[model samples]
Target: MEILDLGLDILTWAAILIGCFFVIITGYGLLRFPDLYSRIHAGGMADTLASFLILGGLALQSGLTLVTVKLIFIIAFLFITSPTATYALAQATFVAGLKPRVDEGQLDDTPPTDKVEGGKD
Candidate 1:
């Protein structure tokens, strides 16, 4: 029993550490990504995966109990809401006329930038 318990603890810790790593990577993505769309994509995907890993770790640590139930509920909520929220934000940005940056090799489909006739040279 003791050995099993120790092994479970080790697995839980590993999951938590991996989750934290993903979160740190997400932060880096936010800083390094060149545009809003890319940043959102990176952050959203990492965040969803990280949440699953971290919550799974917590659920394992909790064992069979009310805490575990609550953790599962939280994970369910996150799973449903995160992607929906990201999609809504991206949609809103599109409706608001925000354009994503295009690389030289990529075909540009975004509307042309509006020129301000009186803007400073």
Candidate 2:
């Protein structure tokens, strides 16, 4: 029983540490990304994954208890809502005429840099 408890503790801590690492990366992305769209994408992805992992670790620590059950519900809510919220935000931005930056070889109404640069062929 002691060995099992020790193993659970280690696993819980490992999950938490990994979740923290992801959260740090997410913060860096939110600061360093070039545009709103990219920043949103980075933040949404990392936040969901990190939250899930962190909650999972907490649930493990809580074991078979009401706290664990609540954690599971929270995780489910997050998983369901995060993506929907991101999509809505993106749609709102689009409706507001916020154009996303596109790379070369992509189809967009925005004129290419080469064309704008004196029509160089």
Candidate 3:
């Protein structure tokens, strides 16, 4: 076996480090944020981004044809599914009428009128 190519090894390590950093930041966001809805945003966004980064790093490190193909599938799945899931969760929050933290009141606890003009028909 030849000495590990320094450049390739460095690249591999960098990718892995970046992926791990995304996960760490996600965890930190989840811990530091206030409110359940806000925390959900943090978690949803973090998991999506971290999943992409990790799949990408793993793809980079995969050195074989079949492994590369499988890695590509993983990347594809993550790209397609993660954001969709996040969007669904956010939509659920909206449909459930959870007031945004900035609103500073539980306004949504009362149903919003569907009227378009100053809540008038």
Candidate 2 — which pairs collide? none
Superposition error at 84 for model 3 (Å): 1.4
Candidate 1 CA-lDDT value: 0.82
Computed on alpha carbons, the lDDT of every model, listed in order, comes to 0.82, 0.82, 0.67
TM-score of 2: 0.83
TM-score of candidate 1 on Cα atoms, chains taken together:
0.82
lDDT of 2 by residue, 1-121 (tens): 9999999999999999999999999998887766678789788956488998899999999999999999999989988988888898888777666677776754444332431223223
Clashing pairs in 1: none
Summarize candidate 1's per-residue lDDT along 1-121 as a digit string, tens digits: 9999999999999999999999999998787766678889887956588999999999998899999999989989988988889998888777666777667875344544643254223
Candidate ordering by TM-score (highest first): 2, 1, 3
- In candidate 2, position 27 carries an lDDT of 91
Clashes of 3: 0
